[model samples]
Target chain A: MLTGVVPDARYWSYTLYGADDYLIPNQDQRYGYNAATMDYVPRDTLNPEASDQWIDQYQIKISADQQEGNWLPAGNNKALSITLRLYNASPTVYENLATIALPEIIKVN
Target chain B: MKKTLIYFLLFCASALVGRTVAIHYLPDYIYSRFSKMALSRPGAAVNQFSVLMAPDENAKLVVKPNPDFAYATLFYDLTDGPIHILGAMPDSIYWSVALYQENTVNFYVKNDMQYDSDTLNIIISDDAMDQEADIEQIVSPEKTGFVLIRVLVAERDEAHQKAISDYLNALQIP
Candidate 1:
């Protein structure tokens, strides 16, 4: 399972790749999730006009089986890779790449 | 004692040979195979930009393709002469042109934020040419390599698709 706060960027996605570095082939044609395609809920319940209080948090379940929401298909391979791409990312993210807050990958049985 | 010395020498020579092959020959061989597969794609060729739609499960031309970005890829062979790339910057959130040698070494990359004007007139050659007033020059390390342009699409709606199409149409390669 992968969970974190989506970065404030123009575009972001988490694409799953096979051990060979190519994309994992699946029948559903679902390779990954972008900021536009992801399902997220705001942390704060502020007034509708207060856009500054909204924080988009997301969780992605990566497994061979179908999950409830934001399912990144892992196929049958146990050893795979996931690439997180952020386009037009904030300067903070680029400057703090070594200390940036990345999604936590929890191994779920 | 003599046999032991000979065995040690053979092992050292084999290790050195293996290291050289792995470092020098392996990457080039792999890149050649990859370039062959990439060039075999329909509408993809040297010196011509091939606009690739959004990637999915079937998109295997490259590794780790972002679904939100539309790509215009071109392979250039500088053996004959230089290649001219002229295009206007797309009004997208993020865009960039990245160049890589045949050995998969990234030589140059210029993003939207790095440019001041909306127009780009780049001359890619093996050696640097005289700087013109409004032209940018890129000296590729390899005679044959690849150039990739990435355009970000926040949404896959009709408007975004048309915008990408218009951007591609405006780009001139000569």
Candidate 2:
């Protein structure tokens, strides 16, 4: 399962594309998802307005078992890379890119 | 056989140099071609938003378009005078305005987080300008280029898309 805590930025987007930058053709025509576009799958009890967890929590469940929030469709073996683009990002984000903390993409057996 | 091999080597060397020159000049060539095309139009002017034509599946002007963002461009020429771009505050959404130089380099840009306000203003000035801006101006070494505005659509509905398109189309240099 692909999961990560997205960075804090004015605008962030997670785009899953083929190895090349070309959009992967899909049945639903859903190529990727962005911060404004993606659904918030609740995993924590944190408030969006109160805390920054709204922009942090992200879990892409690969299993066929459906879950809450919005589905970040990366399954069906079509994705090659999930690009995280942070626009108007914090200065610290760029300063610490080499050591930035990113959640792991765990394998579900 | 030896003469033919030398001629082939000479040809390869010239071809490599030719390819390098073409590659290095490609961006400038494209920029000038497009810039002239844009300015040739009667309404082409600086600091104004011109909504690009709808995306054609068979053709593309730029490249790698995101359907969620509406694209608009402003062709600018500082020959007459320095132009000011003002008033494009995106309503709490993702937005970015970028300026490209004649050489196709992104010389200046401001995003929502950087400058999110009702009075979004930027003056593009060359070195010849004696006046100064109270606010920081977008300094451009090149006097000619284009500005692109990308606004993220909040909803995927047709009505919302149409609204976004209308909003984008309404944007112009005042």
Candidate 3:
């Protein structure tokens, strides 16, 4: 899992890719969020205004059941890569971007 | 002869146990002492730092970046497992976080998606607060490992940078 804080008038996005570096199938279709109506929704549901605003806080969650192929290889193992981009909507360019990583994994028998 | 061999084996077992105890308990003892020092000393302004730990209540470490910029990281170690991070910035800036293997060179994960951009006169924004990317398939490859935390502060001032650093350092496993 990953989380970040974004200021006003700016936008942030999170995308997920399978171990093979391809877009994962979104059966629920609610994989991203924005500032105006910043909340988790199914991927299939489309927000008309999603293309027009910025998001303040974003959270990304990955579950074990949602994976198609073995992300960690054959031995009950897995690895994943994430790409995050931030865009400044104002004329004044923003400096370096800050990010925090939150690990969300538990082994439950 | 059998008695001599048994004594030797007993001595070796005792030595191994002592070594294991020292390795496991030494850092905790040192960390407590340092934490006490930090609290007793005159409060210095905070600096930029990163906190890494596992979601579990046991493994956690707070890392502060050196203000002098001479060192890339103020602290790091592998006495624990997994990795959790929390950070803060003083100014309005953008940042990205990535996870890499122990090699210190390659990033297994990177996040760089943005919602909008503005030109000289025209402004474009994407209300992406609701955008969700499916990450349920992601997993860590290592059985016992660590995660890296990186922060980028827009302004290079002392106080803001310190806050970022201090916050990261204060993170606890709980």
**Which has the greatest lDDT?**
1
**What TM-score would you give candidate 1 relative to the actual structure?**
0.80
How accurate locally is residue B160 in candidate 1, as Cα lDDT from 0 to 100? 77
Instruction: Name the weakest run of 10 consecutive residues (lDDT summed) in model 3 chain B.
Output: B118-127
Interface RMSD of each: 2.2, 3.9, 15.7
Per-residue alpha-carbon lDDT of model 2 for A1-109, expressed as tens digits?
6677667666776655544444444444454566766755454455544443444566665433444555444444444666667767788888998888775777677
**DockQ scores of all models, one per candidate:** 0.55, 0.17, 0.01
Cα lDDT tens digits for candidate 3, A1-109: 4545554336544444445444443444322333433453323336624545434344444555443321211111265545444444444324322433332444333
Interface RMSD of 1: 2.2
- Prediction 2 global C-alpha lDDT: 0.65
Query: Would you list the C-alpha lDDT of every candidate in the order shown?
Result: 0.81, 0.65, 0.37
> Of all true interface contacts, what fraction is found in model 1?
0.65
lDDT of 3: 0.37
Candidate 1 on A1-109: residue-level lDDT in tens? 9988878666788888877776777777677888878877545546534445446788899998999878988887778898888877888888888988889999998
The candidate with the higher lDDT, 1 or 2, is: 1
What stretches of model 2 exceed 4 Å from their correct place? A18-20, A24-29, A44-56, A61-79, A103-109, B1-23, B32-48, B52-63, B127-139, B159-163
Candidate 3 Cα errors over 4 Å, as ranges: A1-109, B1-92, B104-107, B111-138, B144-146
lDDT of 1: 0.81
Please, what are the lDDT tens digits per residue for candidate 2 over residues B1-174?
999999999999999999987878888998878877766667765556677532322223444445456777887878877777665455767677898987788988776767736445777777645555544477778777788888776455668777667767766455
